[model samples]
Target: MGTFKFSMKMLIRDYKKSLFYGLTLVFAVAVSFVFFNIINNNQLADQSIAVGGGTWQNVQTPFSSILSFLIICFCCFMIFFANNFFMTRKTTELAVMGMSGSGYINSTMYVLYQTFVLLALATPLGLLLGRLVIPCSNAYMYERLHISKDVNIIPQEAYIYSFLLVAIVLAMICVLTAGYLHRNDILVLLSQEKEMNFHGSSNKYKPLLYVAIYVFGIVMMFMNPHSPNAYIAPTLVGVIGVVGMIRYVLPDVIKHLKKGVFLTKRYRLISISNLSYSIQRSLLLFTLMTVSVTGMMAILAANQQNPREFVTSVIGYIVVVLLLVVSIVYKLIMEAVTRKTLFFNLWKIGYTRKELKKIVKQEVIMYYAILILIPLVYILFIAGRFIYYGDMTISFAVIFTSAYVIPVILSGFLTYFEYRNAVVKPIQGGK
Candidate 1:
C-alpha cells in the first residue's frame, strides 16, 4: 500500500508524461467499446432476423467486422506505443532508483503499480464516454443509410468487451514493461539522458529500409485484391513508411538543413541547430505530424473515390480528423515539455517572449510544410486518377479544400498557443 502510494505520487509529479498516454487509452477503449457494440448488438441481430438477412444485414455484417478489426488493431498499436513512450520517459528515474539500491523486483513492482493506476483511472472514464458517444455515431450512420432502427446507446456486450479490452491492455503493458526493463541495465538507463556515440550507427541502413518499405507499399496498392485483405498491404505500407520516415528521413533532413542559406538567420540557425542535436525526439514529433496529414489525405482520397459510400466515408473522415487533432495537440504539448529548458536558455540569451514565439512558429511551419507536402503530392497523384475518370466534382473540391485548409490553420494556431502557454509562460514564471 505504501509503495502504491509512492508510485502514485511519482506519477503525479510527472503527470505530463502520463497525461496523453492515459487519454489515448481512454479514447481507444471508448472507440473499441462503441465498435464492439455495433458488431454485436442484439437489436441489429433481431432486425436482421426479422428481415430474413437482407442487403442491410449482409452489408452490416462485413462492414461491422472490418470496423471491429480495425479498431482492435488500432487499440493494440496504441497500447504498445503509449507504454513504450511511458517507459522511455521513466528510464532515467528507474535508473536512479536502481542506483539508490532498489532491487529489480522493486522496479518491476513500481512499473506494475503505475500501469494499474493509470488503467484504473482511464478504463471507467473511457467506458462512460463511449456509452455517451456511441448513440450519436449510430444515429449518424442510420441517418446516412436511411435506416429506421433505433440506436442503442449502451449495450450489455459493450461492458463485457470493454472489460476484456482493459484486460488485454493490462497484459500488454506488463509484457512491454518487463521487456523494456530486461533489455536495459542501470548503466544504460542512466546514460540515456547523456550523449551517446552509438545513436547514429544505423543511419546508413535506414534509407535502404525506407525505400524497401515504400516499394512494398506501392506493390501492395497496385496488387489491389478485391477483398478486404487488399487493404492490409497498403496499410502495412503506410505504417512502415511513416515509421521509416520518422526513424531515418526526418533526422537526416534536419541535419542537412544546417548547410542552407537560412543558416544566416540567427533564430533559424539556433532552432535548426537545437533540432539537429535532438533529432530523435524531433523526428518523433515530425512523424506524428506526417502520420496525421497522411491519414487525413488518405481519408479524403477514399471519400473522393467513392462519394456514394456516405456512411463509411463520413466515419473515415471523423476518425482521421480525431486522429489528426489528437496527434497535433499531443505533439505540441510534448514539444513544450521537452523544449522548456531550451526556451529558457534562449530567453536568457536575450530573446524576448515574442521572438521565441516566432522562432517556434517558424519551426512548426517548416515541419508542417515538409510533413504535409509529401502526403499532399501523393494524394494529388491519386486525385489525378479521379480527374482522369471525370469523377472530380465541386463537392469534393469543397470538402478537400476545407479538410486540408482548416487543419493547417488550426495547427498554426495550436502551435502558437502551445508555445505561449507551455513554453513562454513556464519560463516567465520561473523568472
Candidate 2:
C-alpha cells in the first residue's frame, strides 16, 4: 500500500509524462478497436458472398490490412519511445534512489505500479472512446457508400483482443524498464543526459547500405507483389532511408553549411552549430516528419488512384489529420525534453533570449523546409496529372491547399510555442 501510494504520488507529480503515456495507450486502443472492427466487417462480407448474395460484391474492403499493420507498428513505436522518454526524465530521481540504497526489486516494483495505474485509467477511456467513435465512422462510411448494412458498435471479440494487446504492451514496458535499470548503475544513469556524443568512426560503406535498401524498396514497389506486402516493403525501406538521411546526410549537410560564407555569419553560426551538435536528436524529429509526410503521400496516392474508393479517401484524410497531430505533439514534447538544458546554458553564456529564439526559429525553418519539400513535390506531380487529365477541379484545389497549408501552419505554431515555453519562459522566469 505504501509503495503504491508512492508510485501514485510520483505519477501525479509528473503528470505531463503520465499524460503522454496515457495518450499513447489511448491511440493504441483506438487503433486496435478499429482494426478488429475491420476484420469483423470482412468476415461478414465473406459470409454474405458465401450465402449466394451478389449484392455485397461491390463492397470492396474499406480498410486495408496494411493500414492496420501500420497502425500497430506506429502504436508500438510510440509506446516504446514514450516510456523511454519518461524513464529518461526520471534518471536523476532514480539515481538518487539508487544512491540511497534502494534495491532493484523496489525500482521494478515502482515501474510496475506506475504502469498499472496508467493502464487502469487509460484503457477504459480508450476503449470507451473507440467504442463511440468507430461506430460513427463506420456509419459515416456506410452512408457515403449507400450501404444498407447496420453498423456494429460493439464487437465482443474485438474488445477482448484490444484489452489483451494493451496488457501485452504493459508487460513489454515493465520488462524494458527492469532491463534498463538493471543494466545501468547510479553514476552512469546520472550522467546519461549530460552530453550528446557520437562515438562511431565514419564508415564510408554505410551509405552504400542505405542506398541499396532504398533501391530495393523502389524495386519492390514497382514489382507490386501484393497489397499489404507491397506497402510494407517500400515503407520499411523509406523509413531506413529517412533515418539514414538524418544520421548521416544531415550532419554532412550542416558541416558544409558551416563552411559556406552565408551560414558562417555569427548570428547564424550558433544555430548551425547547435544543430550539428544535436544532430541525433534533430534526426529523430526529422525522421518523424519524414514518416508522416510519406504516410500522407501514400494515403493520398491511394485515394487518387482509386477515385471510387470513398472509404479509402476518408481513411487517407483521417490519417493525414492524425499524422499532423502526432507530429506536432511529438516535436513539442521532444524539444522540451532534449533542448531545454542546452538553450539554458546558451543563455548563461551571454546569448540573449532573442538570439536564442532566432536560432530556434532558424533550426525549425530548416526542418520544415526538408519535411515539406518531398510532400510538396509529390503534390505537384499529382497536380500535374490532374492538369493532364483536364480534371483540375476546385475540390482537388481545396484538398491540396488544406493538405499543404494545415501542416505548415500547425508546425509553425508548435515550433513557436515550444521555443517560447522551453527557452523563452525559463529566461523570463530566471529574471
Candidate 3:
C-alpha cells in the first residue's frame, strides 16, 4: 500500500510521461481490438479476388495477417523495451528507496503498480476507440473496396483475444520487473549511467565493405525485380544495404566530418560527436520505421491501380505513423531522463539554455536526415519511372513527401519540447 502511494505520486508528478504512455497503450488496445475484429469478420472470410472479385479482398486477407502479426510483434516489443528502459532509468530512484529501507519487494511493487495503473486506464479507453473505429472502417471499405461488411456486433472472440493480448503484455512486464529488481544490486543500478561511451564508434574497415554492399544493393534494385537465388526483391536487398550503411558507413563518415567541418562549430561539434554513437542505439528502430514507411508507400502507389489497396493502406499508414511518433517520442523521453547529467554538465561548462536547445534541435535534424535520405533516393527513382510510365501522378509525389516528412517533423518538435521539460527548465530553475 505504501509503495502504491509512491507509485501514484510518481505517476501524477510525471503526468506528461504517463499521458504519452497512456496514448500509446490506448492505441495498442484499440488497434488490437479493431484488427482482431476485422480479421475474423464472418462476411469476408470465404471470399477471394482469385475467383472474380476486386483486388482488395485478396490483399486485405493476406496483408492483414501480415500486418496483424507485425502489430503484435511491434506492440509486444515496445512494451518489453519500454519496461527495460523503465527499470534502468529508475535505478537511482530505486537506490534511494533502498537507502530509505524499502526492500526489493517494495521497489518491485512500486514499478508494477504504476505500470498496472497505466494499463488499467488504457484498456477500457482503447476498447471504446476500437468500437468507434469499426464504423469508420466500414465506411471506408464501402467507398474504396466497393464492399460492405457492417460490424453490428463486436465479436466476443475478438474482445477476448484483444483482452488476452494486453493482459499477456502486462504480465510479461510484471515478471520482467520482478526479475530485474531481484537480480541487480544497488551498485549495478548506480553504475548504469556510466555505461554508455560518449566518445562514439571508432572503426574504419567496416564502412568500406558496407558501402560496397550499399552500392551493390542499389544497383541490384534497378536490375532485378526478384533475386534469382532467394527470390527476394532488390528493394528488400536495398533496405538491408541501407541498414549496413547506418550500422557501418555512418560512423566513419562522421569521423571525417568531425575532422573537416563539424568540429569547427560548437553546436555541430556536440551534435556530430554524439550522433555516430547515437546511431548505434537508433539504428534498429529507425530501420524498422524506414521499412514500414517504405512499405506503406509501395502499397499506396499500388492504390492507383487497385483502389482497394489505397484505402486500406491509408488506414494502415495512419496507424504506422502514429506508432512511429509515439515510439520516437518514447525514445526521446527516455534519453532525456537518462542524459540529464550530461546536459547539466554542458550547462556548467558554458552552454546556455538557448544554445543547448539549438544543439538539441540539430541532433534531431541529423537523425531525421539519416533516416530519410537513403529511402528518399530509392523512392524517387522508382516513383520517377512510375510517373513517366503514366502509372502514378505528380500528386502522389506530394503525398509521399507529406507522409514521410510530416510525422518526423512532428516527432522532432515533440522531442524538443520534452527535452526542455526534462532537462532544460529544471537546469534553468536550479540556476
Candidate 4:
C-alpha cells in the first residue's frame, strides 16, 4: 500500500514531464472520436433521409454506436502505448524494487497505481475536450454553408461514459505492462537500453524504387476512381507503397542524403536526409493533412448556389479535408514534440549539425513524397472513375485536388523542416 501510494505521488510530482505525452494521447483519441462522430452523423443522416422519418433519433442511435466503437479502439491503442512508455521509463526503478525485497505482486500493484493516477488526470480532460469539439465543428460546417442542422451537441452523459471507458482501458494496459516487469529478470531490467531497432533493407536504390512503386500505386488508384471497385485495387496498392517506403526506402534515403550520389540532384540529397528518420511517423502525419486539404478544396470547387451541391458535393469535400486536417495536425504536433525529445537524446550521443541536417532532409523528402502521392493518385484514378461511372460534375473537384497537391506537399515539408531546425538548434548549442 505504501509503495503504491508513493508511486502515485511520484507520478504527480513528475507530471509536467509526462503531461505533454498524456495530452498528446488525449488529443489523438479525441480527434479519432470526432472523426467517428462525423462518420456516425453522416451515416445516420443518410438513413433518416432515405427512410423519410424518425426525426433525429435514427441519427442519434447510429452516432452512439459508431462513436462507442471508435472510442474503444482509440482507448486501447492510446492506453497500450502509454503503458509501454511507462514501463520503459520505470525499468531501473522496478529493477531496484525487485532487488529491495519487493515481490512481483508489489511491483505490479505499484505500476497499477501509477496507471490509475494518469487515467484520473487524463479522463475528465479528454471528455471535456471531446464535448467542446461539437459546437466548434457545428459552427465550422454551418459557416461553410448556411445550412441549418438537426445535429445534437455532445451530451454531458456521453462525456462521462467516455471518461470512464478510457480510464478502464488505460488501467488494464497498466496492469499488462507491469506484469511484464515482474516476469523479466532484475539484471535484464537494469541493463536494458532504449534502442529503436527498426528493420529495413540497406539497398542504395531503395528510395527511387519506392518512389516508383508509390507512383505506380497512385496511377492505379486514379485509373478508375469513380467505381467502388476501382478504389479497392488502388487502395491496396497505396497500402503496399506506403509500407514499402516506410520499411525499405526511408533508411536508404537518409544514407543517400548524407553521402550524395551522382544520380541524386544537387539539393535532392540534402532534402532526403533532412526528413527520413521519422519517415513512417511523418508519412502518416502528412496523409492526414492531405486528406484535410483535399476536403477543403472540394468545398471551394463546388457551386454554392445549388442546395444539392452545397449538401452533397461541397460537404463531401469539406468532410474529407476536415478529417485529413484533424488527423494530420494531431499527428504532426505530437510527433514534433517527440522529435524534440529525440534531438535532446541525440545531443547526448554527440551528434553534429551536419548529421542532424542529413536526418532532417531524409524525413522531409519521404514525407513530401507520401503526401503528394495520395492526392495525385486519388485525383487520377478516382476522378477519372467518377467521370466515367459516378458523375461528370465531380470533374472540377478532381482538377482542384490535382492542382492543390503541390502546394500542400511543399507547405507541409517546409513547415516541418523549419520546426525541426527550431527545436534542435537550441538543444544542439545547449541554449
Which predicted model would earn the best lDDT? 3
Off by over 4 Å in 2: 42-63, 149-152, 198-239, 276-279, 282-313, 316-328, 374-405, 428-431
Compared with the true structure, all predictions reach lDDT values of: 0.65, 0.64, 0.71, 0.55
How would you encode candidate 3's per-residue C-alpha lDDT over 188-306 as one tens digit per residue? Answer: 87777446655545676777877777677557656654212211354576678778888768877887888888778989988776667666777767777767776666666655555
- Per-residue lDDT over 295-359 for candidate 4, one digit per residue giving the tens place of the 0 to 100 score: 33323333344332343333344334433443443344334554566666666776666665555
Which order, best to worst by lDDT? 3, 1, 2, 4
TM agreement with the true structure for every prediction: 0.79, 0.80, 0.84, 0.61
Stronger candidate by lDDT (1 vs 3): 3
Q: Judge candidate 1 at residue 331 and give its lDDT.
A: 51
TM-score attained by model 4:
0.61
| Clash pairs, model 1 backbone | none
Error of 1 at 275 (Å): 4.5
Candidate 4 wrong stretches, greater than 4 Å? 28-79, 82-103, 136-164, 179-216, 222-225, 253-276, 280-431
RMSD of each: 4.7, 4.6, 4.1, 6.9
lDDT of 2 by residue, 1-431 (tens): 65577778888897876676778777667767776665455433433453565434465554454455565556676677777866876777678777878889887787778888878888888788888777776776566545667676555767887888888888898889999999989998797655455544276666667766655655655566333223544666766876776566666666667779647476577676665554465566455555555455445544554422435345534544564456455645555556677778888887788777888877666655666663454345434444444545547655754665676767666766776577656665554
Overlapping backbone residue pairs in candidate 4 total 31
Comparing 2 and 3 on TM-score, the stronger one:
3
* Residue range 341-391, candidate 1, lDDT tens digits: 778888998888878877777776665565556455444544444455465
Candidate 2 residue-wise lDDT at 4 = 72
**Candidate order by TM-score, highest to lowest?**
3, 2, 1, 4
- The lowest-lDDT stretch of 10 consecutive residues in candidate 3 is 225-234
Error of 1 at 339 (Å): 3.1
